[model samples]
Target chain A: GDTSSAPASDAATSSVPPGHAGDHNSVKYYKGIVPAKDLKVWREEGTGNGKLAHYKPATKVDYYKIGTTPTPAQIAGWTIAVPPSGENLPAGSGTAAKGEAIYSTNCAMCHGGFGEGKNNYPQLVGGIGSLGTPSPEKTVGSYWPYATTVWDYINRAMPFYAPHTLKPDEVYSLTAYILNMNGITKSSWVADAKSVPLVKMPNRNSFNWKDPRPVTHNSACMKNCVSPSSIKITSNAATMNLTPRLTGPVDHMKNGK
Target chain B: GATMIAASARAASPAPTAPPADNSWSNSLGAPVDARPYGQPSKYESSVVRRYIPWLSPTRLADASFTPLQDQPGIITSNGLFFERYHSGVPTVDPKEFRLMVSGRVKKPLLLTLDQIMRYPSVSRIHFIECPANGATEWPAAQLNSLQLTHGMIGCAEWTGVLLKTILDEAGIHPDSRWVLPTGSDGAHMDRSLPMVKCLDDCILAWGQNGEALRPEQGYPLRLVVPGWQGNVNVKWLRQLQVGREPWITREETSEYSELLGDGKSLGFTWVMDAKSVITFPCPEKPLTQGPGFYEIRGLAWSGRGKVKYVDVSLDGGVNFQRAKLDNPILDKCMTRFTLPYWWDGKPALIQSRVTDDTGYVQPTIVQKHKFWGHDPVYENNSIQTWQILASGEVNNVQLS
Candidate 1:
């Protein structure tokens, strides 16, 4: 009898949330369950109170996961990253003889034909024990922790301006060549991710993790801090009450005092 | 014999001419044994170095490198001399093989080659590229000498590039696209997301720096030039641009650039650099001469949001301020040179400059800045720089309070 009664039909149709199971209203009941009309909106909104709604496709989805799994060859095309442990070793080998040729053409201009660095270009060989010294310059034999890192870096970025220009085989050969020059591997040895990681660096045990704790700082023993026996005051001027100045001798200062 | 004697007398007699200063070449001249196709800085300029105070960060190269702001006079820093800071080492990229792929949330996923990018309508702008951490030292000590803290990391160059809006349009961005992520082709593969608005506003894909091709270290073939933003966001050795509906919380955005606040909540993805200025001359390294008349106090002022509206110089530190004249061609989101003609009587003087941006954001004092941001210093320390000039014409870095 009232105007509200006339709009009840319209309210029933408009109650369902957009892009939800309730929008497809052909079925009388879903999986032996009938949801109340009022609960349609709640179910559609995913805010239903203990009531299960019909399954609906998600509005947003990751399309990358929807595709079929790529083949090893296809995956390898994009994933050129070689890990420190040599996990993704390709089915190829490269000898130092082949590597020498690649090095001369690609790397020798900047790194020198013999791996001696020129200017800003880094040296690739020697300095096996220079890690802990006052001047620590990193090279293949000296500072690199893993040989696989060299392979990875070369494969990803190298030759200064032209990065990722080398093939996987070429990268392997270059790695072999550099390692052979550094005396880590023999000239005949082929370098892959596996063989590269196994190559031991001379300074592999040189580095120690620095921890700053328990107060590394110390003050003079005569002051508020403990002085070790290593600290010796050689000057007797202080005990004699004669301050030894830089310009004048202690005798003149003592006589003046 | 009489004529020779007359000539000798003329030579021995001091001519009424100004004697030439020693014309001997400086020992710093001549190329090293190995000649470089590209010239490097003079060996004597070794004092002008990129330094990292270890206390800043233990291992991060993104820590800081002061630009030899004192050693340079003109606005431009040679491509090689431009300060570099990287989360990872500089990735050597080959230009010939480089390819830029644009995908995600687009009608046409385009893989544009470097040559294709060069074919686009190009525009050149003289903009200053500055790292967000350019003046990081000012955060700890605001009254520190200006050049070392401020000038070193900022370099002006004529960047030639295509508008990013053109590239986005060419890629056919979908209606759902809200953010664009530019990724570097480096070992770390550093990535950062930009709001669609900023990308469409004034982003550039630069290929040329200064007058020539971009240097290898400065992203030779191509780089994203996000003007007025942090330098890192202007991804070097750029390889990919992915348009998406949401921001990618990459390593650079999450682990590194995010500033940890006093409340422990980090201010994440702070892209825009605030208004900042620094006094270049009469800094710590370059002391003023003993006597002074009309000394031209010069420095740089820039803003990420917009043009530098005004720069104010204060001789008594931050007490009294005078309007410094801005050099011409003050383009939007670019460095503007500000100069103050002042009379330095060689007495002790504390000099500082405050820049006001078009957005009405004034460069705050270090104390004021600390109050708002707290002591959580990572980068983007854009505060007023101060220098103390001693009576003996020695300039030293000093704290205000």
Candidate 2:
């Protein structure tokens, strides 16, 4: 299966082989949760004919204009986000003491330290009258109503195992030390994007943007509909069984109880 | 319960006169055509897997599971127990060094590959995806008690590829574009923003699945369905789309899936995915100890803003309810499967189902989504679930108060 369409017009960096130069190939390549590299192998190099030569184009192309445009500095190195009127934001400006030393060596294990979130990670700071309470604790300064979602989520997902490797002022000093531990600004405040959406979050007037859905317009009731003595009970996730087990087609990462 | 099997109307009454006298695989001679060359699924359906709740990912590059959806039935979703949710793990791409590209506000920026995106013109469809934190640990109450951990992230399949406005109509698009983003070469470069009229509507760019070739944890040769959005914008290993005009949001639309309300604003690209329903045989991993008598309750209803028109059920939780039937083709944002049949009488009831999709939305209770997503709905969490049963018959996963 080595069809050679012959168009070899010289140098492609020579010294080929190594299984067509794809590094070490152990079927690696998956980019998602990233870690596997190695598979390489797409060698076209210096015509030393070690096979793989199917370059027979020019028989009149344009299969929807074939491909190869990518430029603007390769789309500005993947244009990372940070909008919310601070447009693209990526410039710099940090404070709250450089986000407490970039939140202790890249976000303490997983969002801890001043952000107060570490098991199941997500605390970002006090719950400010816990949103209509029932155990609410949203954080990011009492539930993020936007501070450009804290410098676009710490420069697109902060060092949670290295995502976008934070920089724009270390994502504006961890969004000014997580909005100064959620007191919503201070600790000498100073993030960017127009004072990070002008702070003032505190449940930002309890969001609404539509979708209220038929929360309880109750209809389709083929019978009684809400009177069996007003059906009381209210909670119980299966007497604490905690589900988890599901294993059979092959243990999907065990651990249960 | 899940893995309950046999119920095409209860196998159309097939118990007439079964032979019970010395049946040895019905008297021997079986194993033939490539005996076990590659087919298996009947060793008692072996519990149907897809679990992995390792405290829902904190590392190893995020990944989460759960989708045995009560062992599954009618509405497809068996690409090895579907429901995945990876944020970094699962990449091995290599479709001859895949590519995709597309580029922002395009007037002409193509970069296709994966055999020019399987040579464009394809279509299939069936939809579903979900996981706007499918029940984000039931935001504030009755948490995970199976319906594959309360509404297994969700799956549904079929999906075939190419229709992102047929690759943005050969990359022409540029009338002040209006969001597109997509991204996703994995490694948390997940990306989001969608809106170019949902990639010119009906999204897709898929690469098969349910008809095969997509597995690599469901984004093999490429991925990006977006049908009904939020399954983290369906950007599996799909690589790039860009087409801007603003709206990158990212960080999974601003710190994961975004929804939070109860004031403190969050919503962001809400997308569709509203109307929802679920019964999944007697919850808590299929309980009810075989139901005091006749059965058939079944469940599963969906809606990313389409089909599912009706589905009620409620064995008394919402007071009485009834109209359940629904099954067959229902299509649209897929997954329909409903039933009813009744006759338990063993007492202590309280089930629930409630849907209402064709845009009318419905499907809400859990104290009206705890009074409008108070305690900020970590993610979608469709609501109305309930369960109960018990008079020794078992069941549980309750809430309705």
Task: Identify the candidate with maximal lDDT.
Answer: 2
- CA displacement after TM-score superposition, residue B3 of candidate 1 (Å): 18
TM-score of chain B of each: 0.88, 0.37
Using DockQ as the measure, which candidate wins? 2
Q: Considering only N, C-alpha and C atoms within 3 Å, which residue pairs clash in candidate 1?
A: A161-B93, A161-B94, A162-B94, A163-B93, A163-B94, B67-B152
Model 2: residue B356 alpha-carbon error in angstroms: 25
For model 2, the stretches where C-alpha displacement exceeds 4 angstroms are A1-62, A66-74, A81-257, B1-124, B137-223, B226-230, B235-250, B253-277, B280-298, B301-340, B344-346, B350-386, B389-401
lDDT of 2 by residue, A1-257 (tens): 11111122211222331112110111121111111211011111111122213322222223455667777665656655444334445555888887888688878767777667787776677877765555667666665555665676666556756677766878888877777766667687677644554454554445443344445454565676667887787678766656555555544344654
**RMSD, one per candidate, in order:** 19.0, 22.6
Determine which window of 10 residues in candidate 2 chain A has minimal summed lDDT: A38-47
Report the first chain's TM-score for all candidates.
0.53, 0.27
Worst 10 residues of 2 chain B by lDDT: B1-10
Model 2 agreement with the true structure over B1-401: per-residue lDDT tens digits: 54345555355555434654446776788889888887877878777777755666665458677787877977998888897888667878898888878776677776767886787578998888888788777767886666786688888999898888777767766544556777777666677766565566578888889877889987798888877767877888877787655453444654466676665455555666777899898766677686478878898898987899889887878877877889788988888999898788899887899988877767877676766656546777787888888877777787766
